[model samples]
Target: MNDQGEELLARVRAVLSDAGFDETATGAEGVHLIRHARGVMLGWLPEDLAQPRRRGPRRSRRPAPADLPGLRRAFGLAMAAALRAAGLTVETRGDEWLLVAFERAADAS
Candidate 1:
């Protein structure tokens, strides 16, 4: 990775770590690696729970399995916002992996 790529990777690591996700699962090797070419591909595991959750008004901190999708969406948006705030024109997308493409300044014209 180049200098820019390294900087971006650090930024992403900080973002995800602050949001309760780690690049590596507990007691294991790194969970994912960042790949950058035209864009950056960041892979991280979603929620860990496997069982369905009960319908209720009150619950613990953990989200229901069904809520994983929404949770991921929130995380993605948060990441994108952070990147934008850093003054990098960016387009973010993902399923279980996040793909962040920086809109090069020269290409913005």
Candidate 2:
């Protein structure tokens, strides 16, 4: 990851963390997951895909989405907006687990 990548990831971490996903969880295949609810998992996945796990109990389900669609769209939008506001071009890839890339205009030249 480059400096921009690091910054982007940091921003993501902050956004998610502030949204109450402070629990650190590990997913399958060395993937990182932030557990927010009973079956909600969030992360910057490889294929940009992610699914929920039936974790015993949920702490606070406030502002929880009904399904993956809600999670994806809402969180994805937040990430895109944050990245774009930071002057980085946000590229989104995948569905089940969304993959996001941050790029600068100069880097494209």
Clashes of each: 0, 8
Can you write out model 1's per-residue Cα lDDT over 1-109, one digit (the tens) per residue?
7777877777766765665556774544323546668556755445454546669775664554356777666665665566566554455454555566645656554
- Give Cα-based local distance difference scores for all models: 0.59, 0.47
Best by lDDT: 1
List where candidate 1 sits over 4 angstroms from the true fold.
18-21, 25-33, 50-67, 102-109
Candidate 2 wrongly placed segments (more than 4 Å): 1-23, 28-67, 102-109
C-alpha root-mean-square deviation, each candidate: 6.9, 10.4
- Candidates in order, TM-scores: namely 0.52, 0.39
